[model samples]
Target: MALITKTDLYFTDYSWSAIEPDDPRVTGEPDSTLLNRKEGYEILYFINKLSDIWSLKNKSSATKIERMIRFEVPSNIHSQLTIRIWIHDNWNESRY
Candidate 1:
């Protein structure tokens, strides 16, 4: 497969896929992000995974980063969780 770009991920606040092994909702917009249910916990799992990915891929150029994720498992998801990313392109792909 070809290398993936950061934007491809930003499109998702969270992801739920067997390929990456992360739950959904983690990447959903906070205000729009749903929690307090199975979907919420699923999102949490996804947030953790994204954090891991962003750290490894965007560490140097990442001017800002936040999972905006809060709350413990089996608890109510935070109403005001937030995540941010510096959004620097990691790959050497040339853009005209």
Candidate 2:
């Protein structure tokens, strides 16, 4: 259900963007294993705001959440696919 839209990082210099090397849902390379099997269920949709009209267009949730996957099996595709977003900290990773 995530239509491949991404842009949210207040950045202290974090950068990585590599897509289209025969992209089949990026089957394992960037941080180990990612292939949303023929395409589905890689949902990373986030929205946030503390309210009091601090409007990020009015979202009152999502401190942090993440997911990623994009794929195409057929159809005359031009803009292929990719949406790798995985940074949800899981208690700061002790194999959470």
- Tens digits of per-residue lDDT, candidate 2, 1-96, equal 222233442222323354554554332233323433232222222212111112333111222222111222222322212212222223243231
Candidate 1 worst ten-residue window by lDDT: 63-72
After TM-score superposition, the amount by which residue 70's alpha carbon in candidate 1 deviates from its true location, in angstroms, is 11
Cα lDDT for residue 71, model 1?
20
True-vs-predicted CA distance for residue 52, candidate 1, Å: 5.3
How much is the lDDT of residue 91 in candidate 1? 28
Model 2 scores what on Cα lDDT? Answer: 0.26
Per-residue lDDT of model 1, residues 1-96, tens digit only: 112234432324444434333323444334434443223334444444444554545433221222222222223433323222212231233121
The models' CA-based lDDT, in order, is: 0.34, 0.26
Clashes of 2: 0
Q: Which runs of model 2 end up more than 4 angstroms from their true locations?
A: 1-5, 10-12, 21-63, 66-96
